[model samples]
Target: MSKQSASKSNIPLNPLAFIRKYDELWRRMLFLIGALIVYRLGSHIPVPGMNPERLAQFFDGSQNTFLGMFNMFSGGALERMSIMALGIMPYISASIVVQMMSTVVPSLEALKKEGETGRRTLNKYTRQGTLALAFVQAVGMSAGLISGGLTLTSGLGFYIPAVTSLVAGAMFLMWLGEQITERGIGNGISMLIFASIVSSAPGMITQAFTDNLNLIVILLFAVLGLAVTAAIVYIERAQRRVPVNYAQKQQEGRKVYAQQQSHLPLKLNMAGVIPAIFASSLLLLPATMGQWAGTSANPTTLQSIAQNISLVLQPGSPLYLLLFAVFIIFFCYFYTALMFNPSEVAENLKRSGAYIPGIRPGQQTKRYLDFVLNRLTFIGAIYMTIICLMPMVIQTSFGVSFQLGGASLLIMVVVLMDFIAQVQAHLMTHQYHDQTLIKSSK
Candidate 1:
């Protein structure tokens, strides 16, 4: 037993053993790596008629603004004005909008119940929305370039082609992400974002060193990072398992099934990193407008108001942080409510003859579940708020510019945990298949 336990413990530490044993796992992993490589390669290809040096300079000064966050999501593509500067944000935004609408729109709500076919239809709609968003954003970026004097050509010659390139790049990424989801190991869009964050880490570290940060400060930052990562893992794995009991039942042939015990597991963080991402994306809208408005030689009154709004909401500012927290908390409850329905769970449990101990089935069970979930969500909102704000606090205190923000770190850690979980699931499926084969042979 001791030897078996030791071997099992070592499995995760050395994934190479599993890679060698599982052909499908390795092939999927290889495909994922190749797709990310393709994404990184595209990040280096600058758009036509844009000044790369000027673009880099602009981003360098704008690192404290929303543009910096945008660049980070693009794997530094925006810094170079690369073809993929828009990244897959348009798709993400479209997805969020579609999901919100699905709850309110009767047609979409009905489609949500149609299973796989419905999912395909919604994905088509998301793609169309992505296309529209990408075009609008690309046009904005082009106009910003012209206003900021970052473009080589003045007229429609540069505008049309630049917008086309940006839109195409975004669409390509959206397609690539979908392919990865179907053919690769993890969720394609998340994996792409993970790759982007990781690819940019070395540069961030190098920049820290070049900034003459003392060893002690660097050590402190490293310690904080490790602490945050550990906390994330712990909280992510935490769940409240509600005990359930199934009553014995008899079939027509006098066959009786024994009573069964089970659990309904409620995650501490039902929303994951989505709240942070959504809040950031929403906030970027005003900031992007301000960025363009500020560049104009003679700004209109509304533009000036936008510029003022942008100033108040610049990343790391008190107002920005407050709004960020509010949005994160709001979306946490909103998304959790969207994804989980206590009434449905209660109904399903009642139908299956399962009931929580000491609690009546149906409405009572739903109310209990709702109470539990609300408390869990409240705790989760606070936890996420801290995790997403800690890095900014550290940066402000130390006066050090750490390229990794709280949101970025949370996304990276959560995505990696999810990837590992998927791998483990695949492994279990393969093992189950092998065992079935052995049983059949015997």
Candidate 2:
């Protein structure tokens, strides 16, 4: 056999071997776990000056609304009015705004093209935006609590301290997420969100059981959950492979090489779970406003407006579902466009002496890629809409209190897949390194 075949055969198949050889990977994994633990612990630390009973009552009333959804994402932090009540949402909101702005604002767009330096600048802006948004949200939350008589004191002193605590909590969580990204495995923000969802699972399940849901209904939901999970795994793995052929080339000191063939694999759902999250956040806005307005003691024009919106945008409402579907589709395409630039991919392929079979090397290839991506994205959007909306339909129809809904399930499954992929990548790199060293020593 050839040396290549021998080296390939020698690659370690046991995970234990990779672990024994790569201490750094283990350290990174540990660091990620530690960071997530810190986040989970912080989620239980209540903010100062809140009356727990009243706060719990408020959350109970809003439990079926968008606030409940927000609370779920925060791992019940909002329900407890915890220090991490804001969660990582403000950061996500800021990111969405900055990404959208980068498209419309010339300076931001230019910065997007500036590579690492531009990326750093954009990150700085996003951090600043996060702080500002957190502060504003904290203030609003404090005011809402005070208005709802959920605060211990009714004075300026209470507002000042409570808002500060909440804002600081959010900023700290943001810092933790950044640290995780820099020092650990996978996407930190996504991992934190994933952790939140998973951590809340037991409580949600227990709640479902206590709600007196029929055993058969519960069993059915479990079956549906498994089915949805299987579907998600299949869809997430689906990709459209575009064939490329690299022309033969020769180095001045080496023999000419034969033409190489490769394929660019574009995921069916390029946006992943992001569009669903963005859409949920957007839909929750009106619901939040409605909650705050309708909860006031006296009825006002704003309260009436909020009530009307609340009625129209309830979870299972036709209008709510329609708007949700629209937002998901918009963000799926918008985020896909932001993340994968066909022109840039085409340029890189051209520079690397690669061309798609039966297509020209540059603009034509870009157009073709765009066409394919658009079609795939449309299908993906439909898939996401169905997956996300299915839970609401189930809850409405079955009156079941099951919490493992589509968005939660999607986030959990996708993040787990991503985590496994990262570990596999690290293991592969370690194996390759080992193989290279063996070859060099020989």
What are the lDDT scores of the predictions, listed in order?
A: 0.87, 0.87
Off by over 4 Å in 1: 1-21, 252-255
Q: Could you say which candidate leads in lDDT?
A: 1
- Each candidate's number of clashing pairs is 0, 0
lDDT of 1: 0.87
Per-residue lDDT of model 1, residues 1-442, tens digit only: 4776666656544578545558888788899999999999999998899976777677778876777777778899988888899898899889989998999999999999899999999999999999999999898878878878888886799987899999999999999999999989888988888888888888888988998999999998899999999999999999999999999999989999999999999999999888988887787766875786666677778768877887888778899889999999999998999889999999999999999999999999999999999999999999999999989878877777655878889999999999999999988987886565445444
Minimal lDDT window, size 10, model 1 = 433-442
For every model shown, what is its TM-score relative to the native structure?
0.92, 0.93
lDDT of 2 by residue, 1-442 (tens): 7887665555554466555778878888999999998998898898888898887788777766777777888988988889899888889889989999999999999999999999999999999999999998888777777777888896788878888889999999899989988899988888999998888888888989889988998898889889999999999999999999999999777989999999999999999989988887787765775776576777578777887888789877799889999999999999999989999999999999999999999999999999999999999999998888898798889876545679789888998999899999988988788888667545
